[model samples]
Structures are given as C-alpha cells and as structure tokens.
Target chain A: MSVSVSANEVADAPQEARERTILGLTADAWLRILMPLAIGVIALGGWEWAVRANGVPSYILPGPIEVGQTLVRDWHTLSISLWITLQITFAALFVAALLGLALAVLFAQSRVIELSLFPYAVILQVTPVVAIAPLIIIWVDDIRIALLICAWIVAFFPILSNTTLGLNSADHNLQDLFRLYRASRWQVLMRLRLPTAMPYFLGGLRISGGLALIGAIVAEFVAGTGGRASGLAYRILESGYNLQIPRMFAALVLISLTGIAIFLAMTLVSHLALRHWHESAMKERR
Target chain B: MLAGVKAGPPVVTLDGVVKRYANGTLAVQGVDMAIGQGDFVSLLGPSGCGKSTVLRMVAGLIAPTAGRIGMAAGGEATGDVGFVFQEPTLMPWSNTLKNVMLPLRLAGMNRGEAADRAAAALAEVGLKGFEKAYPRALSGGMKMRVSIARALVTKPRLLLMDEPFAALDEITRHRLNNDLLTLWQAERFTAIFVTHSVFESVYLSRRIVVMAARPGRVVEDIEVNAAYPRGEVFRTSAEYAAHCREVSDALHRAMGE
Candidate 1:
C-alpha cells in the first residue's frame, strides 16, 4: 500500500497535465470576427443603395451613411445624453442586484414568504414598465429619482426571481454537513449557500443587464426626462418630433450600440469570473 | 443530564430506533445497541439495509422515529462526534485544506490557527502535499482522503463513516483501510463504519454488527480479534479470511440471499 501510494505521488506531479487548450485555429475563428462586419457592411450598403435609387429625401428613410454623418455632427450633444443614460442604467442595476439577492435569500429561508410573495413578483414582471413609469413620475416630485425608480421596477424582478431560485438550489448533502457542524445560519449562508448561488446569480445578472437598459429607455419615454438629465431616448424623441430623420436614425444607432456594448460587457464579466470551467463560459473559449 | 438518563447508562445506545418516512416506508426498526468508549465497530449489511440510516441517526443528522438515543457525558455537542459521509461532500469551491478546516472554522477558531491544525490533520491522512487543490481537481480516492482528514481534523472522540471506501478503487480502498487502521491506533477514536462489504467490516472493526433490511435491525454481533496497526499481511491471512466468511455468511443470511 505504501509503495502504491508512493507511486501515485510520483504520478501526481504535473507532468503533461493535459491542459484544455484549443489546438488549431479554424475557419470558425475568422467566421466569428468577419461575419458580423460583413453583415453590417452589407446591410448599410443595401440601405444606402435603396435610399439613393429611390431618390428619397433624408427626412424619409435616410441611409446609414447619413446617420453616421449626423452622429459625427452631433457627438457632443449625444455624449452628455449617453453619459446620463449610462449613469441611471448602472445605478438602477446596482440597486436591483442588491435587492434581488437580498430578496432571494429572504425567500430561500422561508417557504411561507416565498409562496406568498412569488405571485407578486410574477405580477410585477408581467406588468408593463410603460404603465408604471408614468405613475412613478406622478408620485415622485424629483424627475431623476422617479426615473430611477421606474427603471428599477422594470429591471428588478428578473434578478429577484432568478437569484431566489439560485439561493434555494444549494446541494442538500452540503447543507446537511453544514448543519452537522453546527455552523451558524449566517456562516452557512456566507460560506456555502452564497458561493453555490454564484453561477445562478451571474446568470440572472446577464439577463438583467439588457432588462436594465430597456428599463432605462422605457422609463425615459415615460418620465419625459428632457431638457434636464436627458438621455439617448430623449434625443431620439426630440429628433423624431423635429422630423430630423437622419438624427433620429443616428440616435437609434447609438441606442442599439449601447445595448450591444452592455451585452458584451456583461458577457466579458461573466467569462472572467466563471471562465475557469463553467459551461456557460465555454462557448467563447471554443 | 436528561439525555444521559434517557440513554440509560451507556456510552452510546440506540433503543428501539425506528425511522419511517412520510410515505410510510420504514428504514429502521427496533434497533437496540450499545457501544462503550474506545470501541471500533462496523455496521455490516447489504445495500439498502438501512445501515447508513443507523449511522446518520447516531450522528444526529437524521432523527429516529421511535427510539431513545443517549450520548455519553459530553452531550450532543460532545464536540466529539465526527461524521465521514459516503461521498466526499467536500465543498467544491474550497481547497483541500479549507475543506478539512470547515469544522474548526465552524467552531469559531481563528483562521490562521485553524489552517495550521487543518494542515496537520491533512498530513495525518497522508494528504500532505495536495492541500492547495480543490475537490474537483482531486481523484475520487484523494477526495475521500480529504473527507477523512476533515473527519479527524477535530480530534473527535467518535468517528462515523458511511461506506467511505465504496466509491474508491480496490487499490485505493486497501490503502485507505490501512491508513484508517493506523489513524484509529494513533487517535484511538471510537469508530463506527457502515459498509456493504463484510470483508471491509471484518478487516477494520473490532466488533461487526450485521444488519438486515426492510425494518433494519442488528441480527448478529461478531467479534474480530484483529490487532492494532493491522497491515496488509492481516488482510491475506487465514484468520482474516475466516472473519470475512463468517461476516459474509451472516450478512447473506441477514439479507436472505
């Protein structure tokens, strides 16, 4: 037994430890990089060709090129508005994450609480943010605070629902061990349940990121938060009202870019935190 | 004091301990047994014989439906009850040392000193160098070793193991069996192991309590005169084979196989 164990020790050394490295570059890699660019170029070229061929004025169906030019022209105005939108989106998301996790823990601890409150959460989720946003504006005197609350209501439920499920999903056996150790409820929660809930929480976070952006955009429409603390939504609405079709297209382009950027940022953060071996993060490495 | 009185003057006793699930399936019944301090015992039976349930009952992880359980002077927190599960059950996120340190950490020991004791416990289980590795990174046997380390890390007066070797390969099992015997000798912990293998039970235990299923109860108690620090030679000896056969026959008879 001693000899065998010694041999295992010898074998245990990290000799050719079989790293999970991707071996060779394939057409897939190039496909990933070029496919989007190709699609974007093709779509924009088609739009340009259609607008020019039809002899449509810029006010009606302006080309992507015209929007880009408008974007360049209105960079300073767009930047301030983008910054405001970004701030509200992030702040609401932060509050939503904290509240979501807290509510999850609360729900996980008591079946009675979970059963009683889960329906209300579902209702909040299904209720249109557009409907609630105006109500929030009417109730709250401060426009900034009201918009934040509206964004929060829109974005918070997904996070709360998903994270509650995550916290409840801890391994039964591990929980038994913790109980046997006479670990305090807090210790068990922090040391075992929270870490176990991480991947799920991150999953919720990814989903909620897009929801947060949508919430901010939707809230802006309802808040009519213009002239002061105006966002990309206000820019789009202003351009639409003024019949600056090219500028409206430009604002639309900016909004889309922000959404894409938020999605990528979230994906990157998830990858960095859980990329070690989590299944969700494996897509990019492959 | 009341627990001691209810237990009726035994170091450890299970009186008519029956466990019935909500669906009315009885896991254990009328299991009366007593263990003195410094005894090495094994609950030997076929799978689903409720042997694991018995161990869990003793460990206070599961309550027996119809039994009076009594622990010795130290009480429930005896601070001496250590349980090693069938699966390693090491927290996947924790490294080997941290996994072993779990109980001590739970006991409110300072982190630095707890790590120190945890390191020594790991060394005692022959897992000296793999302290930094996570349970996911370790082999099955290595993970089991970490469990053993965690079990012994507290220097518990009693150790409860449920089929600790069932998941390992034979080579690893044999090594763990030897290592376990050595640990028992050095620590002198009152060890109660649950196993389906009569050979394994006969090999390590001083007394083997054979159990039968479908309302599990101990039907036989066989004494093994195996000496301390039992090594490989004992495993291959005539005495060892005789003990194995007796326990195996008893188990077969208990199972009605």
Candidate 2:
C-alpha cells in the first residue's frame, strides 16, 4: 500500500531512473561530483570551439580564458559583490530552515492545524516569487531584507513539504514500538522522526539551494540596489549594459560557482549526517 | 478495576476486555485471562485473531474498548515491563547497545548503568561482539536478537512479544526458540508471547491459549509438559509431535477448519 520508502524523501525523484551513465553501470561513487564537473568542462569546451570556429565577437560570447582574465582583473569588485550575494543567500536559507521546520512540526502534531492552513501553503508555493518580490521590496524598503524575503519564498516550501511528510512517514512499526514503551512525544521526535527526516531535509535543501541563488539574483535585478551595497546581480547587469562581455562571463562564473558551492556543501553535510546509518550515503560496496 | 482483581488476584489480569473499533469491527469480545508470576504463556491464533491485540493491551500500548485490565499497581512499568514487537523494530538509527539501552534511558537509569545492563542483555542474547553495529548492518536473525536484547535489558518482570520471530527463516526460528528458552530459564521472568504458529506455541510456551477470530476469544487452554532449556531433539520426539499436531488441529478448529 505504501509506495516506496524513498517517497517521503524525494517526492520529485525521476519516475524512471536511467540506466546509462557512459557505461553499463547502475552507479558510481564519485558520479555526483564527476558528472557535474564533466558537464561543465564539456560545456565550456564547446563554447570555446564555437567562438573560435565562427569568429564571433568576444562581446557576444566571451570564452572561458577571457572570462578568467576578467575575473582576475576585477577580483576585488567581484569578491565584494559575491560576498553580498552570499550573505543574502545564507541569511534567507537560515530563516527558511527555521520557519519551515517549525511549520512542519506544527502541522505534524495537529490535524486541524494542518487541514486549516495546508491549502494556503500550497497557494504560496504555486504563486511565483517574481510576482511577490516587487511587493516585498516596496514594503520592506531595505534592499537586503527584500532580497531575503524573495529567496525565502522560493526556498521555504521544499523544507516544509519534505519535512512534514518525513515526520508523518516514519516507520509505523517503529512508532508502535516507541508507543508501546511509552516514549514521550518529544523523545519520539528527537529519536525517530528527526533522524528519518535528515535525508529528506537534505534533498529539499539541495533543490532550494539553487532556488535561493536564483531568487537572490532575480531580486537584485528587480529591486536595483544602491552603489556601495550592490550584489553580483547588479555587477552582472552593469557589465551587460557596458558590453563588458568578459566581465559578464566573469559574473556568470561567480553565479555558477555559488550554485556549485551550495550544492557541494549540502551534499557534504548530507553525507556526514547519514553516512554511518543510511544506504543512500554508503561508501563501502556490499 | 474490580473486575481485573476479580480474577482471583493474578499478577496480571484482563477481565472481559472487549476491543471493538469505531468501524464496528469487534476484534475481541469479553476476553478474560490471567497470567501468574513467572509463567511463560503464548496466545496462539490465526492471522486475523486477537492474539496480538491482547499482547498490545498487556504491553499498555492499546487500551481495550470495555472492561478492566490491571497489573500490580505502580509495579515499575518503565523498568519492569519489556515489550518485543513483531519485527526487530530496532531504532535503525541506533546501534545494538543503544537500542538495548532505550528502556534503561526511559527508566531514568544513568548512561553507564544502562550501558552495563545493555551489555549483559546482549551477552544473554549471544550478541556480545555486535554492540556497535546498526540494525540495518545486521542479518534478520541478528536484528531479532537485538530486539530481544532490548526487551530484556531492563530486567523487566514481564516480557510481551507479538510474533517476534514470525519473519525469520525456519532454521533461525528454531535456533531462536532454543535461545529464548535458555534466556527464560536464566532470567526467570514472566513472558507472554503471541504467535499464529502452533509449532512455535508448542515449542516455546509452558501454556498455550488458543483464540478464534471474529470476536476474538479463547477457544482452548492447554499446557505443554516440556521442561526448561528445551533443545532441537525435543522437536523430533513423538510426544512433542503429538502435542504439536494437537495444537495445530486445535488451531485449525479455532479457525472453523
């Protein structure tokens, strides 16, 4: 009757996982790292070859080498802007995690509360962040605060949705055992539900990491922040307007690096949390 | 409460304990039973019968819809009541020793004392070297052993199990039946086991209480004259076979066979 043990963790897992991965193998230990790196390398290589062969203008599609030069030349400016973007992303992420977890716990505990507000949450998730960013910007006045609200809106749902399901979807037999032993509700959550939810929570965080980055950048673009406190997005737009193609490519590199850093950091955390107990993070081949 | 005490003052009693669901499903009706001190009893029935329901009620996990159930008042429930579920049901996130220590933690025993108690229990269950291994890392039989260790860790006066070894292979089940008998002999604790297998009932229990489905109630109460620490040779004996067959046939009759 229950679909899969993994359903509570990865709701959007591919319906049919592909077997092919450049060879006849189901998995590779470093595939998560290797696969992404490989894709990035191949993409950059193609971009370089396309530019050279067609003799296109550098302003349109700056090659990786030119982008690297621009990055080195404007290191201080890029670093400051990147730091601002990073600050907003992490702040939003922390708030979203706290709020999402609290909401999940609330919903998990009471059916009435869950039933009353779950539809509103669904509506919030479905509504676009871009549509709400302008409103949040107008109300907040502070550019940083506006960007945080936008990013939180984009990132909060996955945590809440995944965590609520994880809390509810604990092994029923294990739950019965805990009840039989008269374990308190707090004990049940601390010992059972939280551990079970870690994988799901991490999976949610992985998706939300990308969303949060996109949200921060888009929020910057929409709000148009001041000179001294501008983010990577502002620099990106500034470069584009001035036709600084290599510098634009440099900004693009920073954004991609941020996304990759967020992804890798989350993956590392996921491995650390579940490495000992779960099959998902198993290292030794059986 | 008076009804529970009315059963001639048993160590534990279930008097007219009816369990009817809101869906109008009467799983158990007026089930009266008493377990004396230090007795090994098995509630045997088919899949749908209320053997497990009775076990759960005894373990205080589920309350009956009607009538009274009582244990010796304030008699150390946290420390003196150990329950083994159908499957291992070990906290998969915890190691073997930690799983065993859970009851001790609930009992408010200190960590060092709990660890010592858990160690002793694991040794009793023949899992001395596996204290650090997680449940998922263990085989089916080993996990069940850990479950048994966890149940026995508190040195509870009463232990309740609901088809604990039902998921195990035949050899594992037989081996564990022997191991369980040895543990019971060593511990001298009261145990109430729920099982659908008549063979397991005959093999393990000093008394077998057979029940029927659709208003679950006892249809037969028979005693096995087996001694403590029973072994594999007991299974091959004519007397054991006769008892097993009788219990099997009684089970068949209880199911309206």
Candidate 3:
C-alpha cells in the first residue's frame, strides 16, 4: 500500500508542476476564448461552403463573405440602428436598476410592503414582454418611452428578488452585534444591509443587462414594424422585405454583438466592485 | 477570604429573570444572579442550558419575558456594553481597524479619534500589525482577537462573552484564556462569560455558576480561590486541578445526579 501511494505521488508531482499556458494566457482563460471562436469559425465556414457548393441564390442563402460585404456597405444605416437599440437597452437597464433597488430596500425595511407588492413583481416577471408590446406601443404617444417601459418591466424583477435575498442574508450574529452597539435603523441599513446586498445586486444586474437588450429588440420589432424610427430589429425586418438577406444577417450580427457588449460591460463592473472583498471576484491561491 | 464573598456593589442585578419564547418554549426560568463591579463570572452549563440567554439579557440584546434587571446608574458612563459572540462576528467587509471602530462610530465619535482608539484596542489584543487585514485573512484565533478588540474598543463597563474561544484549538484557547485574564486584570471590567467547558470555567472565572438545562437556572455557585494571573503552570498545578474537580462535580450534579 505504501509503495502504491509513493508511485501515485510521483505521478501527481509532474502534473502539479506543469503550468499550462497558451500565448501568455492561462490555459483556462485561453480555452474559454478559443473554444467559442473555433466553433463560430467552423459553423460559419460550413454554411458558406455549403451555400457555394449548392449554388444557392443570394436572396435565399448569402455566404459569410456576402454578409460581411453587406455589413460594410450599410455601415451608416446599421450603425444608427445599433446606437438606437443600445440607448434603449442601457436606459431601460438604468431605470430598472434604480426602481428595483429602491423597491427592494422598501421591501426589506417593511414586511407589509414586501407581502403586498412581491406577488405583483412575480406576476410582471411571468407575463411575456412579446405579448405586452403591441398594446404598450399603441397606448403611449412617444414610441421611445413606450419601448423603454416595456424593457424596464422585463429587466426589473431579478434585481428586486436578488437584492432582497442579499439584504436578508446578513449574518444573524452580526445583526445582534449591530443591535448591541445600538446602531440606529438608518445606520444598519446604510452600513450593513446595503453592503451585504451589493454582490447579489451586481449578479442581478448582469442578468438584467442581457434581458434589457432582448426586451429592447422585441419592443422595437413591435414599434418599428408598426411604423416608427427604426432600431436594429426594424432594420432586419426592412432588409427581409427588400430581400437583402445579407444585410439582415449583418443586422442580426450587430444585435448579437450589442448583447455581448452589454454582458461584458456588466461583468467588468461586477469584477471591479467585488474584487476588494467578495469571494466570487478574489483570485484563487495555490 | 472566599473569592465572591468580598463582592463589590452590584453592577448588574437580575431578579427572577424568566425568558419564554413566543413559540411557548421556556428557555430559562427564575434566573436570579448579581454581578458585582470588576467581577469575572462564568455561566457554566451543557448545551441548551440557556446560559447564552442570560448573557444576552444582560447585554440588552433581548428582554426577559417576566422579570426585571437593574444596573448601576454610573455603569453607562464608562461606555457601551461589549458583547463578544461564540463566532468571531467581525464584519467581513471591513478591515480590523474599521471593525473595531464600529462601536465608537455608532456612539458618534469622529473618525480621527475613533481610529486612534481602535488602533490602540487592536494593539491591546496583540493585533498591532493587522489593522488593515480583513477578517477572512485572519486565522480563527486572530479573528476572535479582532472580535475582542472590537468589544473592548468602547471601554465598556461590562463585557458579555458567549463561548468566545470554544471554537479554537486547545493551544489557542489556553493562550487566549491567559490573555483574557491579563486583559481583565488591567481593565477591571465586569464580565459574564458563558461556556460549557468545565476546565475553561475553572481557569477563567472568580466565581463559576454551574447551571442546569430545561428552564435553566443556577444549580451551584463555586468560587475558585486559585490566585489571579493564572498561566500554564497553574493549569497543571494541584490547586487548579482541585478547582477543576470541584467545578466538574458541580457540573455533573447540574446535569443530573
């Protein structure tokens, strides 16, 4: 048994010493970036090759090159649409964050408010944004405000629930310590509950960041197709009607990129905020 | 003279302190005890004895369901009463200095003065170089030291500790026990410590109140005549052993026959 243990240790020694890296990136980080890149390249290459080999019509199936060329050709129009979509997404996210955080704090402070209002939050979350968009677009005079409201509705609840959970999660012993110090209600809320809720609120913000984009795109589809200033969703619909399939693909690419940008931005914000104290952001020690 | 026989004026007095939870569970019944000025007393009992309940009541963390507690009027002027919980309840988000500064800040002291006193308190607990270190960076013993530093920062007249060193290893526990005794000697605050360890109770307390569970109340009060400034030598000596045995006997009796 001792001989086998020694042999096992010898086998593990080299494994421990081997510091895996790819072009100065740690192996884990390299794999995370490269794996998705490889998949995207392979998928796009296959689609381009298959369309060329099959002699598919440009209107039916545009090659990746055609899509790339169309994206460059319609840069000015698509860029404007991209900017509009991004503004609505971010504005809605900002409003959701403020409203959700304020409501969560209120709920945390009073059980009566939480009980009365929490069910409505759940109700709002369960109802689909797609179903509510047409009515919202028709009722509101300003199209942008109507779109903002729809996006805010979809992005609001996660922040509320997660912040509430985090607020309630302060250690019981620490709460007693606060009481022992005779900390005023405001002091406890500002110093303790707010800090405790920070990581949870950031987590919810990341989720809401993506959802806000989706809600914006979906709302724009309803509003723009109903006759309004075009965001990327409307650009795609217009391209489809004109049989500019490559431009539609370019518009879709821009929308996907916008979603990715929002996600990355939120992630960077979370990392910056939590790196000093939270376990989630801390670097692991060997 | 016996240790508690020469007790000073009562710093804390509990008269028939009964604690009944809203769930209809009686935690402790008729707990009548008085802590004199500058006393080191231990509420020694097994788990579920409600010794913690009594300490919490004294700290004003909770109210007694059926009785009154009186404190010396001048005790409040010393500072806020300190409470060190079983776990090292230092705020994870704050550094050692900030954690210790919490009480003084709550009392509305300016940041500069509070920082000076907090740093001094941390130094008193042998955490001189660790003022900027967070609780997560410290060991269990060091974390408990930070907790102690925070408790004593207010220059409290009374300190209530609930098994503060019970989670530490034997070596750390003994070192902390010695350190605590030293601090108590220097500061001379009235302290009520709750612990289940018989050896710990004997080693630390001037008067050990052995308690029974199930509507907890004091079963026996044993005074340790062992001299002040107890160390490792005293821990192994005949006098300490004798005191330990007597306390152990009281504890066993407190538990059952």
Candidate 4:
C-alpha cells in the first residue's frame, strides 16, 4: 500500500510543476520579468496625467516625458558623472575585500589581535560617514581619496565578520582527520578553512557592493560645494540650485539603475561561485 | 597468510584506560585490551557504552585520563593511522580525487604522485569514474565510499572505524560489509570497529568485545570460529544464525547488568 501511494505522488509531482509558458518563457518567469515593468509604466502614466491636468509646475514634480528629454539632452554631463561615481564605488569595494579577508585570516590565527582591533571596526560602521566627511576631506588633499576612504569604511565590516564565522565553521571531524595526518597550518587553512569561507565571503560581497555605492554618493553630497571634480550628487545639487528639477530627476534615475546593476552583478558572481557544492546555492531537484 | 595464527605482536594496547570529562562525567573506566596486527575486532554495546570513546582513544585523538595507552613502535614510526567517523565528514568543496589526496599532500608528497595514488585508491573503493564528482552531487553510499577511500589512501596499518555504516540502509550495509571484508583480506590492516548492532558485530569481526553502559567498560569477549572469506552461503547457514544468537544474548545480558 505504501509503495503504491509513493508511486502516485511521484507521477503527480512533475505535472503540477510543469507550468505553461508564453512564447519560450514559463508563466512564472514571464510574470517575474514583466510585472515590475508594467507597474512602473502605469505609475508614470498616472503621474504624467495628474501633472498636466492640475497644471503642476516642473519645479515641484517633473513628468516622465520631461525627465526623459532632460536625460537625453544632458547625456554627456550625466554619463561622465555616472562613470566617476562607479569608479569610486568599484575601487572602494576592491580595497574592502582585500583588507577584510586579510584581517579575518589574522583574527582566525590569534584571539588577542581580534579582541584588540575588532571594536574599532564596529565603531566605524555605527558612526555615519556624513559626520566624518568634512574632517576626511580636510585631512586628505585629494578629494578622490577622501571619497574612497569613506566608501571603504562603510563596506569593510560585513566581509570581516562573515569570513571569520566561515573560517571557524570547518567541520570538527575533518579537522581531526587533518590532525591525524599531521597536516601543517598552511595546509589546513588553504584546503579546509578557505573553501569553507568562500560562500560567506560572497554573501558579504553582495551586501558590500550596495553599501559602497551608498557611501560614494553620500560623500559626494557632502563634498558638493567644496570639490571641483564631483560625482552625480554634485549634478543633483546644481540642478536644485537652478530649479532644473527635471534634470535632477534624470540624475536620480541614472543612480538607481547603476545601483541595481551592481547588485545584480554581485548576485551572479555569488551564484556561480557556490552553485556546485554549497547547499545555499545549489539548484533544487524535483 | 596463515589463517590468523597470531600473525604478529599486539599493534595497540590499553592498560586500565580511564576517561573522565572535564564536566565531571565518567565516560569510560578501567578498560584494558590488546589488538594484534591484522586482527578484526568489534567493540559492541548499546548507546552510551563508550564504544566510540575507546575507538577515539585508539586513534590517539583523545588523551586517556589514567593508565597507559600504548602503540607498537613499528606502527608509530611509520605514522600510518586512518580513521572513519559515523558521518562521511568530507570537505564539500573538493572532488573525490582531491579529497583522497589530502593526507599525502600534507605529508609533503608532490601533486603528481599524490594524484596517481589518489586515483588508484578511488578505484579500489569502486569509485573510479567518480573521481571528479563533488561531495554534494554524490549519493549517501557514494559519499561514504569516498570517505573510506580517503582513509585508505595512505595505506595505514591501523584503521579505526566508529559505526561507519550506522547511517546506511540494510541492503547497502550488507554490500559494504562484504566489500570491507575483501579490503581487509587484501590489505591485512588491523581494524577496530565500534558498533551497537549485535548481528553486525558477529558477522564482521573475528572477536566481539561486549560492553555495558553506566560508566562504560567491557564485560565479555566472544570469538567467532568462522573461516576466512565468509560469504552469502554462510550468512544463510544455521551456524551463522547460532553465532548471531549467542552474541545477541550476550549483549542483552550486558544491558541488563
């Protein structure tokens, strides 16, 4: 009787999961891609209608068409600002990864070092970057370096904590096997601890990517009136001063898109790295 | 080679070994035994019988609280000791071949030679075509085979197994038992296996040491006079059932005590 019940379940499971598709895409897949886009279009259409009907001025809330026209007209200026912001974000993220990984390894080796220094990292994370931007800019002659420092500060802690946890989480039995074989310290770290830490490090990377972008933009906002060469935040400030609100909206749109792209790239990297072995990343079998 | 006529001296000896945890619990007490080279011995008991504790002591993984635990100088000089835990306990990131090569690599052997030996070990465990498969992709039985291959890759003279097949189903357990006997005959390594199953111990070991719980210690030792290369025919024979009954009865009596 149990055998026949299991057979019935086995036969029925795939039919329910085999959802129909529109064109080449499954129903669920197409809905996921199209639903967000449809909502965005309808919301914008409503805003445009309401603005024209009520004769609301562009200074208050620019319609979607005006924002689009401003984006195309100011493409050169806006694209340059976008590139500058992205450059700082990527630089800060790279430095954070290298420093966080090195410090985590050191901490794994010695409790004394971790205990003495880890509190400072926590303090840096809790204190807002805006509060320290002016002091950093005054100390550092190069505005780019100041921006990178602020971004690196925001992005370094997650990688440190997560990688430390992963390193310490190596299976106890495997460690015993290594001891039985008389493995060297370097061998145990490279073969067991590092691989155990990869998935966690990637998780931290995804979060740090977004945080780095936020740091760069916030620092740029603080340095807007003082620095000569600046990022998109400076453009927003300039547009607000001149009451070119449409151009400000266009700059905001570009910034959001860039943040989304960074996040998606990090997600792709994490998926590729852990897809084979880690349970968190493996694909579910039916 | 001479059908188990005391092939060599005792490879490992425990003289009144005692283990008391830091939390003030006495896990094992006053256990004394000697295992000869190439002999198959089973430490059989119920749960909390400290069978696994004894196995761990033999592997030199934990210190005995009192008395002397000694290894033959010949075996210690070669540094060849293999261990298989209840779980497979493999590194998830590495493939089967790399996992098997870990011990040799730690011993300062170069990658080329280690890879050759690792592949040979995988073949010996019937995992030849799966050298590149990751641990997550393999089934439970296959993963256990890889763990066994890793343990055997260094040609260890002493192998300590702690209920290695306890998690497997009955069919797979029987097949692995047969395969393990083959490996034992071919390699002639001293095996000290820990198990809670009476029939399993009687079928697998030449001598079964029955243990009791509540401050665990050995109570009895029963010898199986079965011949070498015992197979399915013996498993179905009356003699095998009689041996199993005897061991089971001993185990029941120990538990009652």
Instruction: Extract clashing residue pairs from model 3.
Output: none
lDDT of every model, 2 decimals: 0.81, 0.82, 0.86, 0.86
TM-score of chain B of each: 0.93, 0.93, 0.96, 0.96
The local lDDT score (0 to 100) that residue B84 gets in candidate 2 is 83
* DockQ value of candidate 3: 0.20
Q: Alpha carbon lDDT of residue A102, candidate 4?
A: 96
lDDT of 1 at A90: 86
Question: For residues A239-281, could you state the per-residue lDDT of candidate 3 as single tens digits?
Answer: 8899989999999999888888889999999999887668888
Clashing pairs in 4: none
Candidate 4 C-alpha RMSD relative to the actual structure:
4.5
The TM-score each candidate achieves on chain A is: 0.88, 0.84, 0.90, 0.90
DockQ of 4: 0.29
DockQ, candidate 2, vs. native dimer: 0.22
When 3 and 4 are scored with DockQ, the better candidate is 4
Cα interface RMSD of each candidate: 4.2, 12.6, 13.7, 9.9
